[model samples]
Structure formats: C-alpha cells, structure tokens
Target: MHSKELLKGTLQMIILKLLADEGKMYGYEITQKVKELSDGQMVLTEGALYPTLHKLEAEGLLITEKVSMGKRIRKYYRLTETGQSSVLKKVDEFTDFISMMSRVLQIKPAL
Candidate 1:
C-alpha cells in the first residue's frame, strides 16, 4: 500500500476523478473502487474518506442523494456542474505535475 502521507495529498483528486467517471457512488463503493483501481496498493479508510466527502460537498463540488434500502439509508454522491469543470482542471494540472516530476527525477517512459 502507498503511504498515507502520499495518498493524503492526492485523495481529493482521486475522489473527484472517480465520481466524474462513475456518475454517483456511495462511500463504500468509492473505497472499493479505489482499491480495485490501484490493485490493492491504495486503501481509503473511513477516517480519511468521509471527511473528504463532506469537504467536497461543503465546497459545492459535490451533491448527495439519500435512498432507503430496507431499514437503512445510503447516501450517494455525484459531482455538481462546478465539480465537473473543476475535475477537468485538476486532471490537467496533475498530469502536468507528473510529467514535471518524471523529468526532474530523470525517469524515462517505458518503450
């Protein structure tokens, strides 16, 4: 698994990108998706995930819907119009950062 220190900086971007791609997802689903995508290299505990979800919702970047499943309620989150635009910018910025880091570290792409 990646260090928490490393994952912390990128968590929001990861969440936003996942929501952007998957439409809407609940907390658990998000966690599982991240694990799946990373091939078990990254795991998001509830401690880290919920606060970020709440922050995104508070920022007007995400909106939620609640649905009843039997006796329980599940909240699903999706991006707002603002979030849709923001994710595009975030993805571009991160991509540029990765390229910059590779160049600085003298890492070459695999052929």
Candidate 2:
C-alpha cells in the first residue's frame, strides 16, 4: 500500500471521481471499489472514510439517501451538481500535479 499521508491528500478527489463515474456507493463499497481498481495498492479505512464523506456532503458536493437493509440502514452517496463540477476541476488539477511532480523528480531521465 502507498503511504497513508499521500493517499489522504488525493482520497477526496479519487472518491469524487469514482462516484461521478459509478453514481451511488456506500462507504465500505467505495473503499473496496478503490482498492479493487488500484489492484490493492491503496486501501481506505472507515476511520478516514466517513469524515470525508460527511465533509463533502456538508460542502454540497454530495447527497445521501438512506436505504434499509434488513435491520440496518445504509446510506448511499452520489455526486450532486457541485460534485460533478468539482470532479472535472480535480481531474485537471491531478493531471497537472502529476506532471509537475514528474518533472521535478526527473522521473524519466536521470541527471
């Protein structure tokens, strides 16, 4: 797995992009989907997951609907209009970020 701190910085964008692409997902489902996509290179914990979800919901970027499964309620989250806008911006930002980091690190060409 990658470092927790590094993943923390990108997790929100990652989640947003995932939801933008996949529509609705619950917390554990989101985490597992990311893990699956990344081939287990990164893992998200509930300790870190819920707060981000709540923060995005608070920021008007996500909307949640609760569904009852047997005795439990599951909250599914989906991107709002704001989240869809943010996803495009974040995708550009991350693309630029990776490009800048690659340049600075001289990743492809040794000095």
Candidate 3:
C-alpha cells in the first residue's frame, strides 16, 4: 500500500468519485471496494476513513442512513444533491491537475 502521506491528499476526492460512481455504500464496503479496485495497492484504514466520512457529512456533501442488519446497524453514505454536482467539478479539476503535473514531469497521462 502507498504511504498515508501519498494517499492523504487524494482520499476525499477518491471517496467522492467512488460514491459518485457507486451510489450508496457502507464504510467497510467502501474500503473493500477500494482495495478490490486498486488491487490492494490502496487500503483505507478506519482511522482515515471515518474522519473523512464524518467531515463530508458535516459539510453537507454527504448524508448517512442507518439500517439494522440481523445484529448490527450499518451506516450507508450517499452524496447529497450538492455533493452529486460538486463531484463532477472535483473530478474534472483533479483530472486537469494530474494532466498538468504529468506534462511538467514529462509522463504520460494515465487516462
């Protein structure tokens, strides 16, 4: 897995992009999906994940709903309307930033 320092800056954007693509997802499910999608190169720890999730919720970009499973309550998160709209801007900005950085570094754009 990459260092937290490497992942830290992009975590929120990553979460937003994932939630934007996948709709609602619970915390563990989000982590697992990330690991699966990244082929285990990025693992999100609860320490980092929960605070980001809480911050996004507090910021009104995300809303949480709790559902009781057989024995445990699971909190699922989805984008608010604002979040849904903001994600496109975030993704586009990040993409452009990456493109610019790649140009400076003389590396090919990943996508």
Candidate 4:
C-alpha cells in the first residue's frame, strides 16, 4: 500500500473525480471504490474521508442528500456545477504534475 503522505495531496482530487464519474456516492461507497480501483493499494479510513467530504461540501464544490437505509441515514455526495468544471481543471493539472514528476524523477515509459 502507498503511504498516507503520498495520498494526502491528491485526496480531494480523487474524491471530486470519483463523484464526477459516478454521479453520486456515499462515504463508505467512496472508500470502497477507491480501494477497488487502486487494487487495494490505497485504503481511505473514515478519519481521512469524512473531513475531505465536509470540506468539499462547505466549499460549494459538492452537495449532499440524505437517504434512510433501515435505521440509518446515508449521506450521498454529488458534484455541483462548480465541481463539474473543477474536475476538468483538476484532472488537467494533475496530469501535468505527473508528467513533470516523471521528468524530474527520470521515469520513462516501459516497453
């Protein structure tokens, strides 16, 4: 698994992109999706996940709706119009960052 330090900087972008792709997702769903997509190499604990979600919601990049499942309520998050645009920008920026990092680290494509 990758270290938390590596994951820290990209967590917001990850969550935003996932919501943009999936339309809407609850907290646990987001965590599981990240783990699945990363082949279990990245795991998001509740401690790391919820605060980011709350911050996004506060920033007007995301909105949430609560639905009841049996005795519990699940909060589902989806991108706002601002978030939709932000996803495109963030993806482009992250792509550039990766390219720059590769150059700095002298990483080359495998055959």
**lDDT per residue (tens digit) for residues 37-107 in model 4:** 99999999999999999999999999999999999999999999999999989999999999999999999
Local distance difference test values of all predictions, in order: 0.96, 0.94, 0.93, 0.96
Best by lDDT: 1
lDDT of 3 by residue, 1-111 (tens): 688897888888989999999999999999999999999999999999999999999999999999999899999999999999989898899889988998899997468
Model 1, span 34-54: residue lDDT tens: 999999989999999999999
Which window of ten consecutive residues has the lowest lDDT sum in model 4?
1-10
Candidate 2 accuracy as lDDT = 0.94
Give each model a TM-score.
0.97, 0.94, 0.93, 0.97
Local distance difference test, candidate 3:
0.93
Clashes of 2: 0
Worst 10 residues of 2 by lDDT: 102-111
Q: What are the runs in model 2 whose C-alpha is more than 4 Å off?
A: 109-111
lDDT: the better of candidates 2 and 4:
4
lDDT of model 1 at position 16: 98
Candidate number with the higher TM-score (2 or 3): 2
Rank list by TM-score: 4, 1, 2, 3
Query: Where does candidate 4 stray beyond 4 Å?
Result: none
Give me the runs in candidate 1 sitting further than 4 Å from their true place. none
The CA lDDT at 91 in model 1 is 89
